[model samples]
Target: MKVLALEGQKHIKSFIDFPHDLYRNDPNYVPELYIAQHDLLTPGKHPFHDHSKVQLFLAYDDQNKVCGRIAAILNNNHNAFNNTTDGFFGFFECINDQKVATALLNQAELWLKKQGITTIIGPANFSTNETVGLLIDGYDSPPVVMMPYNYSYYLQLIENAGYAKKTDLLAYDVPYDTHNDRSVRLLGALQARLKRSNIIIRKVNMKDFKNEAAKLRDVYNQAWDRNLGFVPMTEKEFDYLAKDLKMIVNPEFCLVAEQGDKFIGFALGIPDINQVLRKVKRGRLLPFGIFKLLFGLKKVDWLRVMALGVLTEYRKLGIEACLYGLIIQNAISNNIKGAECSWMLEDNYMMNNAIEAINGKIYKKYRLLEKAL
Candidate 1:
């Protein structure tokens, strides 16, 4: 086998298309949109490229067939914040071969070492801001819109390559039909209490998206700062992300909590666009792809509660429950069969308990791996 760096359009196309063949027989596998992958890999188009460098490599068999691929990334922002040199491996795909997996990991490790990196962690497609983690469990169902999925054997390949578990990211499923009645009952009461305190939960104003995103950014940084591996996004990055998500943000499900004029908490739900993207075939959006995406939106059966947070001082005030309840209520009204409130830290008891209170089941598991280089 020979390892090759992705240097041209052919290699790039191979890098993106390898997974289609790998998971062709897996019923739950979803093909990510090709154009989105291209944009993320391209330097100037993604904010990650602004502060980090990445090198992608593809493994080829003797006949020159693409058998595996991996990306070695040097996240300057992570290193700068933690004061340690850590590299990352992402956008990884491989056939079920230990040798190929080991070779790909070794190549990534060597590349990071040359860049003075001492530790490596990931499966993060780019960063925590994007899709991250290896799907170790829940292969019975297709992933939600932006979640990751991989063959179960990938876990063994990774462990055999000397990587150890760094953390587990949990994904919960909340069925609109069967979730806890208590949460449903308390929701109105909580909203009433919040109203008494001048904390009103309302839909996001698309007309004021810029200003609304700015306010949420402040709350996001403050609320999530204490969580494990949390990093504050720069204003530019936040705005960039907000612009992309706005296209899918449903006003009823994307809500904000305010105390008079202060933005205290928020919840964001997005249609599981992956359902449409899976049919986009290599992520292209030309010819019929764009039509499929646009027309498929109303048919999506699931929603992903991608973001829910309450400011630190606002904790214990039931704002978190209010945000969740509102999102759930909206999902039910829209006929969304189920929703995923996911990628939660394993130790986040507060959020987990709130989710459990609403009958969200921990259905999927993703792991972050780390190793000394």
Candidate 2:
């Protein structure tokens, strides 16, 4: 087998298309859009390149058949914020063979070591700000849009390669039909109390998205500053991400808390576009794939409460509960069957408690692996 660095346009195409062939028979696997992946991996197209660097590699058999792929990333912001030189490996896909997995990981580690990195941590496709973690549980069903799905054996392959668990990220499922009734009853009262304090929760204003996103940027940076591996996003990066999400942002599920004219807290729920994207085939929208995405949007049954944050001074004021309640209410009204509030750090007690209060069940688990290079 030979490992090759993805260089020219042809190799780049191979890098993006490899997953389609790898998971063709896996019913639960979704093919990410080829265009989106291309833009993201391209240096100037995605904001990650502004402060970080990444290298893509593809492994091939003696016959030149693509066998595996991996990405080695050096996130300068992550290193500067955490005060450690840690590299990352993401977009990892390999055959069931342990040797293939080991070879891909070893190459990634060696590349990072050459850059003076001391530790390697990932399966973070690019960064924690984007899709991160390898799915270690919940393979019975397809992942929600933007969430990850992987073969169960990949876990063993990673462990066999000598990476230890760094942290486990949890994803909880809140079924509309069986959610905790007590919390549902309390939601009304919570909203009433919040109203008395002049805190209003409303859908995001699309007309003012630029301004709304700016307010959210402030709240997000402040709210999650203490999170493990947290890094403040640059303006360019934030805007780039906001623009991508804006296309699918539902005003009803994307909400904000306001006291008079000041934005205090926010919650963003996006339709699991992965449902539609699963049929997108190699992540391309053109050549007939666009219609599936365009029409599938209306039929998406799941929503992901990807982000929810409240200002520190606003804690315990029921603002967090209100944000969740509003999103749940929208979910119910839209006839969406369930939602996943995800990728939460295992140690986030406050957020976990709030989700548990609403009878959210821990349904999926993803882990970040680490090794001393």
Model 1, residue 189: displacement in angstroms?
Answer: 2.4
TM-score of candidate 1 on Cα atoms, chains taken together: 0.96
List, residue by residue over 140-197, the lDDT tens digit for candidate 2: 9998878888889999999999999999999999998988756556778988898999
- Per-residue lDDT tens digits for candidate 1, residues 330-352, read 78889999899988999999999
Q: In candidate 2, what residue range of length 10 has the lowest lDDT sum? A: 179-188
Per candidate, the number of residue pairs that clash is 3, 4
TM-score of each: 0.96, 0.96
Number of backbone clashes in candidate 1: 3
lDDT of 2 at 161: 98
